[model samples]
Target: MPFRRKLLEQTQRDIKRLKNKGHKPTTLLGIFLYGGTLGFLFVVPIVGGAYLGLWLDELIAGYSEHWTLNLILLGIAVGGYNVFRFLRDKT
Candidate 1:
């Protein structure tokens, strides 16, 4: 059909135009901000875990640091996983 042919021609032209265009990040500030955000995302959980773990350990009123240590390790693992997932999706 003539209509189909015209539609196909238009799509072809659009594709060619798109092929000439480049999408990239060219801003230093943007790069730093994104990096900071990624770092923040990765650090918050660890700090939060540390705080919570410390509180939990204090509740038992003892000289043991099992909860604090375990939670801190858990936090590190969670932060690493979060950063990994974020980078995977973003980049």
Candidate 2:
């Protein structure tokens, strides 16, 4: 169909444009390294938040898990934002 041909042509053009924009094909090792880095970025904040919360809880005494839970949630939010920003910037 004419429509299908047009779509294919557009897709090819887009691919060409992307290629011209310095988008090199990535290797498997690069992908794995990116994945590992992303995972570390997402996890470090969470662990740090948990540790800080635990320390705060120890210092405070009465609330117990209140600080820990709140900080963990905050960490997750921050980590998600961080990952989003990283991906956005890289892309």
lDDT of 2 by residue, 1-91 (tens): 9999999999999999988878677899999999998998899889999999899999984769888889999999989998999999998
Error at 53, model 1, angstroms: 0.3
Task: Please give the TM-score that candidate 1 achieves against the real structure.
Answer: 0.75
Best by TM-score: 1
CA-only RMSD, every prediction: 2.7, 8.0
Error of 1 at 27 (Å): 0.7
lDDT tens readout by residue for model 1, 1-91: 9999999999999998788655654699988998998999889989999899899998896687888899989999999999999999976
Model 1 ranges off by over 4 Å: 1-25
Per-candidate Cα lDDT values, in order, are 0.89, 0.91
Question: How many Å off is the CA of 85 in candidate 1?
Answer: 0.4
Q: What range of 10 consecutive residues in model 1 has the weakest lDDT sum?
A: 17-26
lDDT of 2: 0.91
